[model samples]
Target: MHIKERLFGKTAGKEVMAITLTNRSGASITAMTYGASLLEWSVPDKAGKFDNITLAFDNLEDYVTHRPFYGATVGRVAGRVAHGSFEIDGDPYQLETNQETNHLHGGNSGLDTKVWDYQTEQDDQEARIIFSYLDAEGSNRYPGNLKIQVTYTFTEDNKWKINYQAETDAPTLFNPTNHVYFNLHGTVSKTILDHQLFVDADRFVELNEQSIPTGRRPDVAGPPFDFRTARLTSQATESTHPQTLQVSGLDHPFVLNHDANRLDVSLYDPQSGRKITMKTSEPVVVIFMHNGASPLKIANNPIPAYAGITLETQDYPDAINQAHFGSIVLRPGETYRSETTYSFHIE
Candidate 1:
């Protein structure tokens, strides 16, 4: 059977209250609409016993008071924008930037900070939840009255389907993605260094220290940034390499090998015999591995300092500013549509 939960604090209006997704193996995935955040996800291990695979805080206090942006939905724009500024139609616009100069995760008050309209339903082992929000013309200092709808469905087959759509009364740029950390071998393990990762990408955008694309799409072959073949991820982070130092791990987007329809990206854990496959209609996907920092720094998790890797699917990081890059602009009367799915299967 499917279950639903609703929580509200007299002071806090419309908390996630409850999530209604089933665990195919009798496990559970508890989500909250608070940040449109994922609070709990239960996945199986080698012993056929399911465990909470992602690292997350237990309560709203932990989420609100301390670490957020972990396992939560980030919006407006997902990655970083150089110098917290961009030019659209030759107009220069600057945002309230973070991380010392870059605009990280939309802005100071991104989509995670807004109150979303919650629509949910359940039947038998299947559950569906939809989160919608309206953005004013200058809410984030961006243009247009934008309406976005995100539908999350938990299937009996153990698939987490995410479908996103948006329409604007005026012209604006849009990019949204879920930032979830995964450790198939369980949390508290040291590095995902040994796990095998395969990305069907032949090229990747190089980034400057600010995490903004340098507008150069380099060949992924022979460089440390290469993941064309299934290889150990840590190889890209050796002592003498470029993909190593900038805040650590794989945080860059891979220009996919397949078209912008459905493509499969896989990660396998030899220790647990578990596998994760990521599918999306988007052309760019960012793979980020947690590098272990204090709770005040990054998102809190129950891992050995650095124990998870994040698979974030989206359009390019800073597309609005880069004309050479793909288009993120949603014009009037045009609807933007995209879908990404994260499915789990056993070996």
Candidate 2:
């Protein structure tokens, strides 16, 4: 195994660094300190050709100007919070409503936009990069000073693992996830409609027109939402179901039926014979199919609609307000931990 680091660019007067970790099998993943973002995951397909399967910009200027979550670490909370209002221990706190009337992706300046401190480690079997950030208390109007560490591990067997750990000085909400969009065909010009997906979920959180949860957990027994068995992504994207039509694609959070020993999700592209099997400790997986074309270009090619898909394993959005959505509160003296693993292979 080997690791390399290079200067990526300058952002906010701070130098951003890109770290690449490679295993003996010729597979590698690269991450940047800016946003603690993932830039590349190059692996061989059935034909032994390597290609990056994630959506990413070629330069730092584009990432700074055009913001799609694209492989960035999303936090304070991963999804929308209703009206950006929540109470902690009877004290009501209001956050910036960056998205219409909801607080989306931790507000205008979330973890995804920050440059983090990092350290690297490696052994005979694996390589790792740890990215750390300090979220000051009252920043974006959230409580507590949060010290967070995000670790990415690349294994010799082609597994990409993420482990998140955090501690807060006071009561606060903490729910984070990585927003990496994957197009197994290795290019953003190609849509993911042909990819097959399987999600081990029986129900999904229902959202309103504003995309905030309506406190409903609807069963996924029929078309569109059902993914209990592997099915083409087009089966959901091309459907006329109200839920599918509402967002122009699949963007709902499905409550996961978690099993420590079982893989909970799988995505495969038959054309490339590449597959990703995922397992997470989180209770939900938000499946987002890129619903519209991106103005940005990848490798000089225009990004098309449904160019990629995100399997964001995270806690349910707006959990603080929804009684059944569970709690995301991290109080003093408590340690928060979440982990997810994605294994790649040729089908």
Candidate 3:
């Protein structure tokens, strides 16, 4: 089953806001263009009941107005950069810092503000919503007349396949990803303290006091950072680190088995009978615990702080500033392409 038919509504300036993709197994995923975010992921629960597992809101305005970063398509650079400055072609450039002295989520006017193009193809086992933007050189204070596109597709294989591509006119840095707060428990305030998790990386990025890279790659085998086996999120949260106070949860970058064109991650929630496998074509995975405060907008809503648990599949955060770390540079003839697939199954 896939998008059987797509309809265009009368209002809303001709944007394809609501799209549904049906899996071969009949499971479905929904997406909206307001933030170019995945709105709901409906999969089987423990008792075989279909439930929306992704934490979401009731309407489109919730996405546009919510500062919670609920399900956002982030770009330019997704994570934080110390003082929002990066060196491109041996020139140091500073970006607009929205989060204090730190540049966060690509500054104030990031990708979330733009609307994407959508097409519900008849042959696709999925529906895709695409967003394209042209960033002139030095737009984000980075050197590039960048043309970028981020596509979110829901496949019949039970995968949310997110693909990103960009080509820069000048030498610059680009790290883009979808910042989705995933919880198998379904949007609650409970500490993910007991949720068991695992990863296949041996080393992680060490950070300074402001969540900036210290330029040190540390081993995970002996620390609470190690999640090669099934381990609880609380264990990593309670462990010791040099910059523990800066990032409360697991807000570190893990060096992955690299590829010239891919990045991937696999996560599962046993209690909910949901298994999510993420695959991408990138060098670094910024795994954040979302341990940061929610700044919860709804005053009375019982929803607690949600963990980002994001596998930010891209170059390292603040990569433009670190020479030893790799750069996300693409030449005139080069095309920047990255794909991440999130496949879901019930155990």
lDDT of 3 by residue, 1-347 (tens): 56632432322454536666777666787766655666678887778787666666655555556655666778778888889876656677888888879898877767665566655554545566566668677665666688888777776677788888888777766778887766765545554555666666778889887778888988887657787666776776677664444666677888876443432456667777777766667777877776755544332345654343666777788886787887766777788888877877777
Best-to-worst ranking by lDDT: 2, 1, 3
- Give lDDT: candidate 2, residue 275: 99
Q: Give the range of the ten consecutive residues with the poorest summed lDDT in model 3.
A: 4-13
Indicate the TM-score of model 1: 0.90
Q: Which stretch of 10 consecutive residues in model 1 shows the poorest summed lDDT? A: 294-303
User: Residue by residue across 1-347, what tens digits does model 2's lDDT show?
Assistant: 89999999998899999999999988999999999999999998899999999999879988888878899999899999999999988999999999998899988899999999999999999999999999999878899999999999999999999999999999999999999999999987679999999999999988899988999999999889899999999987779998889999899999998866657999999999999999999999999999988888999999998999999989999999998888999999999999999999897
- The residue ranges of model 2 lying beyond 4 angstroms of the native Cα positions read none
Scored against the true structure, residue 206 in model 2 reaches a CA lDDT of 89
Please give each candidate's TM-score: 0.90, 0.99, 0.87
Mark the regions of model 1 whose C-alpha exceeds 4 Å error after superposition.
Answer: 8-14, 123-125, 259-263, 296-305
Candidate 1 lDDT over 186-251, as tens digits, reads 664445777778888888888887778998888887756677677777766563656557756667
Q: Of the candidates numbered 1 and 2, which has the greater TM-score value?
A: 2
RMSD (Cα, Å) for all candidates, in order, is: 2.8, 0.8, 3.5
What's the true lDDT of residue 286 in model 3? 78
Candidate 3: misplaced stretches above 4 Å?
4-16, 136-138, 189-191, 258-264, 293-301, 306-308
Better of 2 and 3 by lDDT: 2
